[model samples]
Target chain A: MHNFEFVKPGTVADAVAALKGDEAQALGGGQTLLPTMKQRLAAPETLVALSGVDEMKGICKDDEGRLCIGGGTTHAAVAADGSYPALSAMASHIGDPAVRNRGTIGGSLANNDPAACYPSAVLASGATVTTNTREIAADDYFQGMFSTALEEGEIITEVKFPIPEKANYQKFVQPASRFALVGVFVAKFADGVRVAITGASEEGVFRWTEAEEALSANFSPAALDSLSVSGEGMISDLHGTGAYRAHLIKVMTGRAVSAAA
Target chain B: MELSDSRTIDAPREMVWQALLDKDVLKNAVPGCQEMSGSPEEGFEAVVVQKVGPVKATFKGAVTLEDMNEPESLTISGSGKGGAAGFAKGGAKVRLEDDNGQTVLHYDVEAKVGGKLAQLGSRIIDGFAKKMADQFFTNFQEALEGPAEQEPDAEVADGAETGEKKKGWFRRMVSS
Candidate 1:
């Protein structure tokens, strides 16, 4: 790894300021970043550690019933919270215990790995990503694989997820990594159903609109029987093919809806 | 792994074909090409810095156009080494179909990575390759269509000219 200076900031403003230095990178939990650094794939001149930012590390419920998660809040903390069962269950199953203790929702969303678990929940729950400078809707926040609306030096301070009436996330785990090979999060809101899928697309987390429409009219696993997702743009690797993943999306969505029911 | 995808561009087939041979267009279209020089005929050399998720590396590589059939179909193959990070080599078979005046571009891509990158996992490489191929074609199409006004988003950082450093590895690949 390249030699670099590291600084832990106490506040979001301080973290942002520290990241303005030459070739600086924000360190979140270091679950992904540290491993990458060790491989010498990512080398920053300065590392701005966000863990020390005390204000960004908790889970709370707002007056509007939205679950507000601090950016620094770890998977372990979120898993321990019983407020959002589906979200917490998803969090509990992320990687191993070590990763659960260190990986943060903000970091996971920031990295926006196509295979990660939080994005499916965030997108399905229609969460709002609060950055230091602006608030972005979950729909607008995720652009593509590892891409987000957050500008350079932008830090995700909080995520506000509107608790759904019923929600469940079903993940098909990739054996070695424990990352989702294909994960589906089904959320039933008062007005309609919102279905978001991850670990399946090259476009990152995306809404399975057809399923959402079907489930909105009739919320059940059978509602997805007529709907099928094309594997054309889905991610294909040694673990699974695009067609396999496309098939899993429906299977997982069915499983999620049943579990939610 | 083999992946197939297609894109439709607003420009004419001839224009799209011409742009494919243009070094400047490919340079601008290349995601992180910091420096690219050489003709399509003689093969081009480039220095690129890219961040795929968290893996950021300064890749020094070479691109060579192969199986030229003028405006119909061609293959673009490139191989790059990112020091200790690892090395990658890939190829894309691009075919063009002229729809009236518009060009419909179809591509088949395959990529492989080894060393630390491969060690990281198999899950990422295929998706990264597919994205890269699709991106290259998308960028290629956009280059021909319009919007030359804005700079390419991928080309960041202006490093000093890296002159004649590593030729041994590429020499073997190119020859072999």
Candidate 2:
């Protein structure tokens, strides 16, 4: 809506350098940033596009048993790659085909919307956010609703997630946009289980420790039956009540567990 | 959407209630609050940025305290607009009760959103509302719990990590 300058950088270093000013924003897929700008919610004087940054795109596995995903990888590539089922499924479900084809992981995490799928994935998988200056733990990376620990001008180079032993993501999508109304990502690691929920509760993206504890003892669907997701602090709106969403957490947790199993 | 949850704090009700009233403490605890300042008397003003799915909006508004019962119970309400992203308004009735030496907080919050947030993004609104509420209470818990943070041991948990939870890893790999 407002007049803004755009700069497509040739590399991650170039993009970071160009993002020095206060009103400068880094554009990845333009899935989130462009919409915000068009809505006039954000009026950055300059957009440092990372599309040309070669180092900021792709997928690879490290010898350390970790997978590193570049920030600029489109959702389409992810969803089409069956090797990464969870990421592909998540990307496939984001908005629609157009959005999936264009949305990038770096842009999504940098934006850090509480209900965004990537935040859930990162948090659930216990990933690391690798940026220009620092590598933030997944827990520290997400600060709060639409907020993150990233300093201004910091560009997320890649995110590292340990390949889970077995994992699955279950989301109850809103019909129109295919975004999670309430989604759950469940992983059973060696020490314990990790359960992450999105689109259901107000705490933003969070690990359901209680449910994880239940699953750690027993990784079956019935393990979550006795776990009561309290509605006391859950969000209530036109689509559903706090209790309703809380109910979905358990139900979806079961489905994700079963799917992963 | 409606979000309600309670957590038991190991402190007295009065102390917990007082903590709720402390603006500086609240500013730090409330999620996505870029800036929050004001008094319980004049009602506090805050700027909150929220993102759900593809929608992102920043809301600026004021919150007022009502139905105060000192260190026992109170009601807090606020309304804000996020321009084209949408507008939202809500209030919470919070109560603190003594549970032995601990205090248990009970809250009931009601909120409404208009514009694109209400129209195009209604499905996840409940989830978003619930998540925001959880962040509010959780932040309160953290503030009460103190910040002697624990370093999450990723190396220890790496082997156990597996499954479709690998999306972030794939994305990272793809980008690299």
Model 1 per-residue lDDT tens digits across residues A1-261: 888999999999999999998899999999999988887888899999999999999999999999999999999999999799999999999988999999998999999999999999999999999999999999988888898887779999999999999999999998778889999999999999999999999888999999999999999999988989999888888888989999999999999999994
Report the lDDT of model 1 for residue A174: 85
Chain A TM-score relative to the true structure, per candidate: 0.99, 0.96
Q: Tens-digit lDDT track for model 1 on B69-160?
A: 98999998888998987888888898999998888888888888888888885676776777777667755655655433454433223323
**DockQ of candidate 1 compared with the true complex:** 0.56
Q: What is the TM-score of each candidate against the true structure?
A: 0.88, 0.69
Q: What lDDT tens digits, residue by residue, belong to model 2 across residues B1-176?
A: 66576878766676677777777556655666777889988889999776553354779988788999998889988789887767888878898989997889999988788887777556456656666676677656555554224632121122343232232232232235
Please tell me which predicted candidate would have the highest TM-score against the true structure: 1
Collision count of model 2 = 55
Query: Which residue window of length 10 is worst by lDDT in model 1 chain B?
Result: B161-170
Which of the numbered candidates is closest to the native, going by highest DockQ?
1
